[model samples]
Target: MVSLEVVHASNARLKELGPGLVALFVGATSGIGEYTAKAFVHNAISPRVYIVGRNQDAANRIIKECETANKDGKVEFIKADVSELSEVDRVCKEIAKKEKHLNLIFQTQGNLNLRGRDESSEGLDRKMALNYYSRMRFISNLLPLLRTATTTPPHFSRSVSVLGSGGGTALDTADLDLKNTFTGSRCAGHTITMNDLMTTEFAQRESGITFSHCAPGAVKTNLARELPFWARTATKVLYQLITPLTVGQDETGARQLFMATSGIYPPSKPVEGAASASGVSPDKTIEVTKGASGSVGDGGYNLTWKGGVTNGKMLPEYRQNGVSKTVWEHTMNVFARVEKINQERGNVK
Candidate 1:
């Protein structure tokens, strides 16, 4: 496992990687995304960073800090509520209009939603939309530019989703949208499976990019605000009790940066089938970890907060009978329905 000090050291040396690197961070209004954005600006050389979220005040503060961190870097805020598919598409269009290639895309747009099942106006469970659907939309829409980045000078672009990585489980194919399978434990399982499996499909389809589903463990953030009162109170007490064990924002930022750049999960290049597409060997700086798809260097990576491959079961069903294909079809159907509605209302194209 990579140590925190080494992660920090690697992040500090990111300037040597050259300039003009572009990054788009979703759900960066606060918490882990915010810290990661600031760290990127501080280390990168003249990078262009986009912070997307709904809070104007939080955006302003983050932008100002990022600007101060690196005067030459470009830091911009995009205001949008990511729980809605329409907003996700709009924000992605804005990024596409501005950037020709992206070096990194980091997403963590979700909360615990302990209050209960809350659905968005777009007819999706709000938490699932933010955590799973919206993230996939960003990855799907920005894929062309990400591929361009790999073919371009940098030769790689990263897509990292900060969520439950070590938690893939058997998906209820009958109800992919959780319409009928929305219990607390089941909700967590469904979301985790969706996150990892979708990333896996994307990695297989786009061999040039690195797709990572990272479980950021438990950092001390406001992500549990939506929890019911008693649960929230209990969490607060537990957080204070486990002060020494909790990951601070600073450490979390550096560790995420390592995942973005380190050769542990080498960027892919084709070699027959994708799961075995372990092309170039890892560089000397970091130890290489095999991907969730069984490739030494390629395929979708399931990472943990401690800079290690997560030790958890990837449901065997994911590999049987074209499960990945089924999940993609369902996700696309959901997107198509949203797009059709938006087009009919004269709001989208």
Candidate 2:
């Protein structure tokens, strides 16, 4: 586990990489996303940040606090129901129009619920949509700007998704979307596995940008608001009991900022001896962890909450079985189908 002090030290150097860092925070209205947005605003130098989510009130509050934290940083709230792919595209289009390049994309958009298979208007299970499909859509749409971020280690273009990373099981490829077997648990498992696959695939294809699927660990967030009353009560009680063990929201934000800027998860095509460029001497530079493809600096990482690699025992098997390619093809097909339908409906341009 990386210590909070180390995380803070690394983040404190974000300014050394240069200023005018552009970032997009999907689902920053509350919880981890909000905290990380605040951290970015507090630490980054003259950052232009976008806060995208459904809650304007919450976004407004966050934006106000961010502005107070860094008067030079510009934080804009973009109202978006990102669970819908069309909306994700629209949000991405808005950002693309405004920014020439993006330095980081941090996403923590998901709901914790036991409800079974709630479908979105687009015919996707709402939980899966929020956790998987919508995130991929945002990344795909904004990838052009991400690719344009020409920077050195610790401040390159990167996308970090806070979800179940190493905690996925082998997928049932026949039911990748879990349309037929749509239990809440199955939906969660499928989305988790799909995130891993998608991250791996994107890292392999997009050589310069880094992709990470990370477990947020035991951070106290309001993710369980959608749970049943009994479940919500239980979580509250459990949270109190485990208060000493859980990382504080502020510290979690610092750690997440560390993941976003640290050279430990370098891009696939790393600059020769790039560790020295991360605002630290070579001897003092943090070691680079292996990516999801079992290669050092391969650009995809499944990270633990403490900034270590996850013990994804199923990842190797999934790779050998070519599941990443299968998942990518299926996801792209779904995106194409949804885009065509939304265009016909005049819901998206």
Candidate 3:
């Protein structure tokens, strides 16, 4: 495991690299997303960043802090309810119009949704949609920009989704939505599996993108408050019971910044159509954890909170039964059906 000191050192190195980078922060109004965004601004070189969320006040506060932290960092806040696919599409289009290439996308756009599976106007479970579909929608819509965004070697591009990345459970393929059978635990597992499988498939197909879905273990953040009164109280009690394991906000931010910029997740060779970035890569001086595929320097990674890959026993069932590909197909199908219906209803946005 990489030490926090090393992580902080790597982040600080990005400052001297000079900046012509663009980053989009979704669901950064609070929690890990906010912390990570601020950390990036504090260390990044004169980067232009877009922070997206529903709360203007939180966005303004974050932007102001980023300005104070890094005088040259251009921080802009765009408000949107990203739980809806329409809104996700709209935000992507807006960004596409302004920037031709997007260098980094640090997405933490999800809530715990412990109140249970609520349905949005889009008819999908609101929590699942936010965690899986909405996040993927943002990526799919902005992939062109990500490709255009890659500027230098060593830096390449990165998309880090902060969620459960190392745990897996029996994914009921019959009920991807958990409609006929729904439980809070089951829903969480399904999304984790979806995240894992999607990122896995994406890594193979798009080697230019440095992709990761990380489980942040336990962290002190506002996400705990999203649970219902009883559930929230239970979580707090659990946190108190396991205080030693819980990561501090600043440390979590440093680790996240390491994931976003460290050399550990560089793109593949030119056969993958990207000139394998070469230069003074941070973490080059230290042993960096390999990509999620278990090989050194692969583009995709699924890591624990401590930057180690542990794909739990249950995930192999997904690969053995071709469940990962099954999920890739199912997710694409869902987006297709939803977009087609939305377009037919003149709700394309």
Candidate 4:
């Protein structure tokens, strides 16, 4: 496995990698997302970025930070709640209309410590909708635009989701939607694991798109703020104990920036350096071979924070029961249903 060293966020290499690239960041109001956006803007040669968040004031602050980092790059913020399908659809449509293609989509939107299962006004579980389904919907709605942006020069557009990689022990096919199975604090854990599985399954079926599900390990972010009081206190204590081992916010951003631009991960690359030599390669690695059109193969990647690709043990289950196909069909069905509902409500333009 490639040893991923923690580098300074202002590394000069990032600037060389980011010219003319357009990236959209969702859930970047704070945490790893926010730091990554700032790092990208700072190090990119001349990047145009779109920051998505629910808070206008926070988004504007992020934009200002980006502007200060690199005066040459353009930064724009789109305010929206990514958990809502209608809002995601609207934002994606606006992006599609404005740009011919998008180079990267970073999904870091999340609220851990959700006390209970809450459904959005659009009739879906809020956590699941935001962490999984909404991201899928964004990809589906903007796929055509992504395809249009790919030219002979090979402008690769990648979709990177920040969460757990590989199947968590808690995942169950029966409770894919988490409606009837699992409850309590484990619900968030289940949601994260299921989303990882679904993301891998979906990316495998959608060739040409580079998909990566990364586990950020543990960074001190605002993620724990939503936890119940006791849980929050416990987590803080735990973080204090493990702070030395955890990655910092700026380091997380640098790793993400590398994932967004590095050609080392193309579909045709070998997996020699991708796998970890020990301990469930924190960097989940998989190789995607290119097809005749130079698009990636069906299998997506599961990566660690450091950019190493490692496979989880549960992969065989997905391949055996055809979970990949099942996930694709189910996700598309959800998108279709959501689209129909939105249209009926006159929400889609």
Give the top-scoring candidate (lDDT): 2
Tens-place lDDT per residue, model 4, 8-59, is 3214454433367778888888888898888878876688888898888888
Estimate the TM-score for candidate 2: 0.94
Writing each residue's lDDT as its tens digit, candidate 3 over 46-68 gives 88899999989888888889999
Candidate 1's C-alpha lDDT? 0.80
The candidate with the higher lDDT, 2 or 3, is: 2
Compared with the true structure, what per-residue lDDT tens digits does model 2 show for residues 62-104? 9889989999999998997777888888888889889888888
Using TM-score, give the best candidate's number: 2
TM-score of each: 0.92, 0.94, 0.92, 0.83
Task: Answer with 1 or 4, whichever has the higher TM-score.
Answer: 1
* Backbone-clash count (model 1): 0
Single out the weakest 10-residue window by summed lDDT for candidate 3. Answer: 271-280
Residue-level lDDT tens digits of model 1 in 1-349: 6787778777776765578889999999989999898888888889999999888999998888888889999999999988888999999999999989998999988877654567766778887888889999999899889888876664657899998787766778999888876766677778888887776788888888889899886788878877788889999999999999888998889888888776567655633343212222334666677787776766578888876877356444574568878889999999998888878877773
List clashing residue pairs in candidate 3.
Answer: 292-301
Cα RMSD to native, each candidate? Answer: 3.4, 2.2, 2.5, 6.0
- Distance (Å) between predicted and true CA of 315, model 2? 1.0
Task: Give the poorly placed runs of model 4, Cα more than 4 Å off.
Answer: 4-11, 14-18, 152-154, 182-186, 198-206, 228-234, 268-299
